[model samples]
Target: MTPKEAIRLAINGRTDIGQVRDENEDHIGWYNHPSLPMGFVVIADGMGGYTGGSKASQIAVKCVTEHLETLPTSTFQACTPDQQLLVIHSKILDALNAANAGILDAKVSAPQLANMGSTIVLALVWQDKVTIAHLGDSRAYLWNKDGLCQLTSDHSLVQEMIDSGSLTVTQARSSRVRNHITRALGVTEFIEPNINTYALIQNSLLMLCSDGLTEYLDHGELEFVLSTHRPALECCYRFISEANEMGGKDNISVGIIEYTLENKVSVSQANISVPAPSSAPVEDVTVRKESRA
Candidate 1:
């Protein structure tokens, strides 16, 4: 039997407009196919002014989800598991490209929204593996008994500074330009998303969140929460509440996926190999504490 047929997943998501923001510009969503062993979680953080920010994020989430839903599932299922992963990665990039175009088109129709843009992080899970994709500073993380590992890199000015050895983690956290992102959807004609795949170990958790939660909590704090073994929904609320307690200066969004092997099958020890997308060159930044304005 396929790994997807042998496992179960519990998913939950949450978004909050923190103490300082007058409007919530972050969006989170998840979709699980009824028949196929496939699902996805998406989070977007918008930028620009009040109206533009909200609209841009909403549009990005909607467009990406819609595009992904249209992929040929049966075609993908016919390929080997490794090949299926590549197809999924390609489709995710296609979705992001479509979303970028949709946002750019919205800007043309509404001149005032010219400055609108957004950061997006998405996780597409198929049976025992997951494909994670992202643009800008939003992130994806994996947590298990071993601890928490950040999977996606931040595409931000502060990250660039740290990568160049010009700024230390302590310095970047408080830097005035810490929130300035180097890449975002709709900011340019095209975007190169960082995509990767990983094995979804049984009893492990996958998290996707905007900078809001990361702004307040570090990796140690995140590990503590996941170690509690609470339900995925409870973890989502805890993350949002903790971020708010820590000065909630921006919008917060999170999506959690918990994987479990059912009684029918034993855990597989195979590793899923994911090749980098060939569309554009993407820089891989080391994980760090990131802040948002």
Candidate 2:
């Protein structure tokens, strides 16, 4: 169990023997480091042949967790809003690169795994800051003053249709193309993931999950449930249960984060600060060429 502090988290995850497959190919993990109240939540949904799909998702979670462990602990100790965002952006990019490589390496040994890939969504919270980075269809949602806001975009064909106005939300529900994802870890040699950073105050909750959960619930439904829930963990439990009741067609994973309001602290009493950088921007190299007919 991860030692939770500022945000107490309760996690509930299950893989279903849905209408199609024999095993669920999803992986999830959550932990709070002893060095700080900050914690991380990760979920990966795999696709490919038998052994290959499972390994791809497992490798994704391991790679991300290992990369986070190597970062300087000071990054999470507490800092100005800008500094926190910089640290998060840099670290997330590094982890995604590593996870991509891990999947590719696995493919080299087993050629059948060449197309093995997984969708990943990872969220980190340290004090009042929240950061999310994702690839593929896994998502993150926040229940706050503005209501439920989806923080990650789906990288699937159905999502593209919705974005392009070719399909309405109702049409997407039954679209055979709903499962076609545009991106994944080992499907290609390189991947550029989306990273998001935001600030959180009191009365905020975050939901990190795979499509198994979101595919069944609308934004308004989730908001009302999460807002009225008890422990953060129970919220996760209910979400999964509801999804299963509707149709547990895939693996389910969820991570919840609830921020407790901290008393207002004066600037002088804050524990950390970020100093401005002193170096100037570096210039890019260029070469000129002339052509003659």
Candidate 3:
């Protein structure tokens, strides 16, 4: 079954190799535990060369999503309502660290791939709350009646330039160092992933994606896309298609979680009931599109 049909909370995701890249170095996905109410949405953008970038991105997604999905549901369910959010935060943080370590470990024998690293953004979605942990430049955004609000701060040099008043937002868009991220998975022995938890209002849409989509569509264009009021899957496809239309400068990936009344749980409740799932989780399959040169 497709993610729209099989994934909980109307979650769906898609990724593309883009027009230029020989291999897709981006990964996007969301998967829930076999019996837990929580789900994980991860986006990773890889850098380096010699085919190592793709592997790094794949390792990032695999490490974070697999580790988080298998977390003990009973431990989460057993927590007090107030402690549940904390548990979510810790779980996401721990998983991100693990992903960082996994990427470092993969470089053990391959000397040429030593510089390979990846940007990551992971959202742990539960009832009315999303705890995000990220490193490097992949981002998380929430779109609602209020419009699109960027949920994650980029860990790129351009971002630092913007923060330090050295580069205006417009200038940063075209800055030579825009792609030079300040940090990434496997770059350091210990990683400090940024973490934040947000209250998800009903009808709000949470999007996790790589920089390729953002490089093309600005906030206004994204608003226009959402104004179509399309289903989660359609909106995600629009994101990928539009980015490709804009010259697909890099690999593109998108994962969306639409929070509606149906997915909302009571504030007092620590966990929601999840229907039984099969032995293996269903993955969203993406077709890599080739550009017409």
Q: What residue runs in model 1 are displaced by over 4 Å at the alpha carbon?
A: 264-293
**Model 2 vs. true fold: TM:** 0.81
**In terms of TM-score, which candidate is strongest?**
1
lDDT by residue (tens digit), candidate 2, 1-293: 11234344333444444444567788887766564557778889888968777899999999888877655465444565557567777777777777888888888988978778999988887655667788888888777665677777787898878878999878887899888999777777667677756656445677888888877887667877887787655787888888888878777777776655544432221332221111111111221111111
Q: Write the per-residue lDDT of candidate 3 for residues 53-168, one digit (tens) a residue.
A: 88898888887877777665777667765587767666666666777777888888687889899999888776556777778888877777756667777888998787788988
RMSD of each: 5.9, 9.1, 10.1
Lowest summed-lDDT stretch of 10 residues in model 3? 284-293
Specify the poorest-scoring 10-residue window by lDDT in model 1: 284-293
For candidate 1, write residues 76-123 as lDDT tens digits: 768986687677876777778777888888899999999999999999
Error of 2 at 130 (Å): 0.8
Q: What is the lDDT of residue 223 in candidate 1?
A: 79
Which candidate number would show the highest lDDT if scored against the true structure? 1
In candidate 3 the C-alpha lDDT for residue 33 amounts to: 50
TM-score of every prediction relative to native: 0.89, 0.81, 0.84
